[model samples]
Target: MRLVESRLTLTVSYALLALFAFIALFPIALLVLNSLKPAAQIVQNPLALPETIRWENFTNAWNHARFSTTFLNSFIITGTTIVLVCTTSSLTAYVIARRKIKSWKILTFYLLATTTAPIQLYIFPLYFGFAKLGLINNIFGVALIYTALYSPFAVMLLRTYFIAVPKELEEAAIVDGATHWQVFWRVMLPIVSPGILTVALIIGLNSWNEFLIAITFLQKQENVTAVIAFFLLSGQYSSDWGEIMAAALIIVIPVVALFVFMQKRFIEGMAGGSVKG
Candidate 1:
């Protein structure tokens, strides 16, 4: 009876997981399928396989979306935000974790609060300030906003990894005549690198996909991110759904490829960080 029940449970669990996987992948499969079909074909039947593969959709998307310029803009913004968040958050996390300051609790509360607060509350004020400073449509300015928006969560997550590191490493580094900066740079950072990489991947994906802030701040066609460019591909009266899907696929490919490549490290980082602190 026990053996039979165990097998039944396993079968049910596998069935549920398969169902969930299908649910998750269904939309993506549809997107890829529709992307190859003409707008007329898609309107007729989105589920139908294309009778003829139209490779031109991809080319048309690339040209119409101005991906040549927008892709570079996205890379610039994502890279800048990643570097700023990792450097600053790692330092802050290290200090908060190792120093045992009385005010650390207050700082933690502030970070938690910031993460929970909606960006909508500050968007108007931020836009006004950036306008006054002539930062609208500025690539670096958008990167700065991304950095500020992501840093709180990065610091909070990284703090756990920093805390998990053994204190003896810091003590030994200091005994060997290492400066505080040297200790953090040479010892702590190396140990918590997985956490940093995880933060970078998450921030990069968010920054790449972010449309609201990008559209609001980057008004110029030259300065818009890839996502914003993809959005602009839709016409007011009528949209070519095939071209739109192709544009969507183009924008998604890089980030999806990156996540797949770094998935192991990302998993390790999440697990390592969550195990303690």
Candidate 2:
């Protein structure tokens, strides 16, 4: 009787997991399928497979969205944000983890508070200051904004990895005549690389998909990121749903592929960070 009950529970667990997977994948499958259909066909029956694949939808989307420009803009913004977040957050995390100063605890608390603070609290002043400084519509300026908004979370995530590193290693490095910079650069950084990569991926995704700040700060047609460019393709009046879907796929495919390839690293870093601090 015990063996039978265990088997039944296992079967039910598998069934539930399968159901959830289907639920998650069903919309993505539809999006991909409908992207190949014409707007008329989608209107008629969104679930029906296209009789003829509309290869032109992608081309039309590319032309309409001016992807050539927006893709570069997104790449610049995402790359800059990643570099800034990783460098700044890793250093901050290390200092906080090691308690290098009497105020380290207070600094950590401040960072935690920033994470909970709402964007609305600061966006106006930030925007006004940026406007006064003529930083609007500038890719680097937007990247700075992303860096400020996302770095606290990165610091929190990376702090765990720093804490998990054995203090003896730093001591040994110092004993070997390594300077503080050298010890951090050559020893601590290499050990916590996974955590840094995890932070990079998360920051990149957030910067790429971020709509509110991107749209607000980047107003010029030439400066808009891919997300904002795609937003223009959609409107309340009428929209080319097929082209919209194609544009979405274009923007999403790269991110999805990257996550799929680095899924193991992402999972490991997240799990390892949580395991300790």
Candidate 3:
């Protein structure tokens, strides 16, 4: 009876999960299918199967969106943002976790408290500040924004993971006559790498897909992907649904795949941090 109950419960859970999975994935699947059809084919039968694949749509989008330039700009911004966030956030976490210097706790609390507040309230001031600094519409400007926006959470996570690591490891490194920098680079960093990697992926994905700040700051239409390049597709002489879907698919698919590929590691990192803590 227990075996039968377990089997029945498993079956029910699987069925429900499958249903939800399909519900979530169906629209994305439809987008990809539509992207494969020509615009006229899409109109002739909105729900119809593709009569012929329109592989050129991707190429056309690549040109029409000025995607090459946009991608390069995005790459510069995302890569720089990730590097800055990881470096600064990790160092900040180390200070918060390990160093017992004056005002460190107060500073951390102050930073974390900022997260309880909303970014919307600060946008006006931030725009003027960025403008004064001549940072608006630049890759460095976006990187700065990403670092400030995401660093608090990253610092919190890293601090948790760092706290879980044994301090004796650092003591041993010191006994081995390694300097503080060496200890940080060679010993502490390796120990917290999984958490750092998870944080990096999260920050990278966020920076890659960020639209709001991009929309506000980026005036050069040819210089940004998600907001500037992608948004232009909607201006209508009749909607090019096929092209829109193609562009979206192009943007979304790789990020989805990256998450899928890295999800096990991400889960393991979170689990390991919890267990160690």
RMSD of each: 2.6, 2.4, 2.9
lDDT: worst 10-residue window of model 3: 268-277
Question: How many collisions between residues are there in candidate 2?
Answer: 0
The reply for model 1, stretches above 4 Å from the true place, is 1-4, 100-102, 235-238, 267-277
Off by over 4 Å in 2: 1-5, 236-238, 268-277
Please give the TM-score that candidate 1 achieves against the real structure: 0.91
Clashes of each: 0, 0, 0
RMSD, candidate 3, Å = 2.9
TM-score of each: 0.91, 0.93, 0.90
The list of candidate 3 runs beyond 4 A from truth reads 1-6, 235-238, 267-277
* Candidate 3 structure quality by residue, lDDT tens digits, 62-122: 7778778888888888888889989998988988898657888797888788766687888
Where is the poorest 10-residue window by lDDT in model 2?
Answer: 268-277
Native-structure RMSD, model 2: 2.4
Report the C-alpha displacement of residue 12, candidate 3, in angstroms: 2.3
Against the reference, the lDDT scores of all candidates come to: 0.88, 0.90, 0.82
